[model samples]
Target: MDVRPAAEADHASILAIVAPILAAGETYAIDRDLDETAVHEYWFGPTHEVFVAVSDGAILGTYYLMANQRGGGAHVANCGYMTSSSALGKGVARAMCLDSLDRARQRGYRAMQFNHVVSTNTRAVKLWQSLGFEIVGTLPKAFNHPVHGYVDSYVMFRAL
Candidate 1:
């Protein structure tokens, strides 16, 4: 798989993957009613370093990396990842995350943090753990999952 910075041409494909996930209200904490323009801005806004994972000319996943906080916290990084529904279990998210780590180090980040990982997303939780992230904290009943009602969320971190 090839992981590269996203371009305008990748917008539609990015939405194809992001929209459903947002609509499902499963993992991400974004608004479910976001229109295309808002979604585009959120994904490609100035604050993020967006990337896409492609294989055979098709986008398999996308992710965005940014500062976890400003000023005193700029040394740490935060990221959000989304894999195409059809690409699950094919290692696309893994490759993007591995690439993000390298890119984060290159950008001088001291650590990486995931602020709100839904506990019900076990695949992602396990994957992050296997990639060396630690669950530093858990927020009780943080995410309102569509099917599962209220669920806990975790704060995952890893030193770069």
Candidate 2:
């Protein structure tokens, strides 16, 4: 798999990966009916550094890294990742995360944070933990999962 910075032409593929996840309303805290324009703005806006994981000329996963906050908190990085349903369990998400860590370090970030990891997404929670991120805080009933109703969310972090 090749993970690299996303080019403008990759926008369509990125949308393909995000659409189902967003529509499911199971993990990310986003509107289920968000249009392509809004999705584009959120994922590929000027503030984000977006990347794609490609294998055999197909995009299988993607991620975006940015400052968790401005000014005083700029040293901490925040990221969002998504893998195509077909690529799950194939280590695509894990690879993208490792790449993000390296990218964050290269950009001088001192830490990496995931502000709202859905607790019910056990796979992600475990992956992040295994990758050295700790669950520093939990927000009870923070996410309204489509299948699970209200669920807790976690704030995960790790120093770079």
Error of 1 at 118 (Å): 0.1
1-160: candidate 1 lDDT, tens digit per residue: 9999998899999999988888788999989989888888888888999999999999999999999999999999999999998999999999999999999999999999999999999999999999999999999999999899999999999999
Candidate 2 has which clashing residue pairs, if any? none
**Ten residues in sequence with the least summed lDDT for candidate 1:** 36-45
Query: Residue 145 CA error for candidate 2 (Å)?
Result: 0.8
Which residue pairs come into collision in candidate 1? none
Q: TM-score, each model?
A: 0.98, 0.98
Residue-wise C-alpha lDDT for candidate 2, range 8-90, written one tens digit per residue: 89999999999889888899998999888988887887899999999999999999999999999999999999999999999
Q: Give one clash count per candidate, in the order shown.
A: 0, 0
RMSD, candidate 1, Å: 0.6
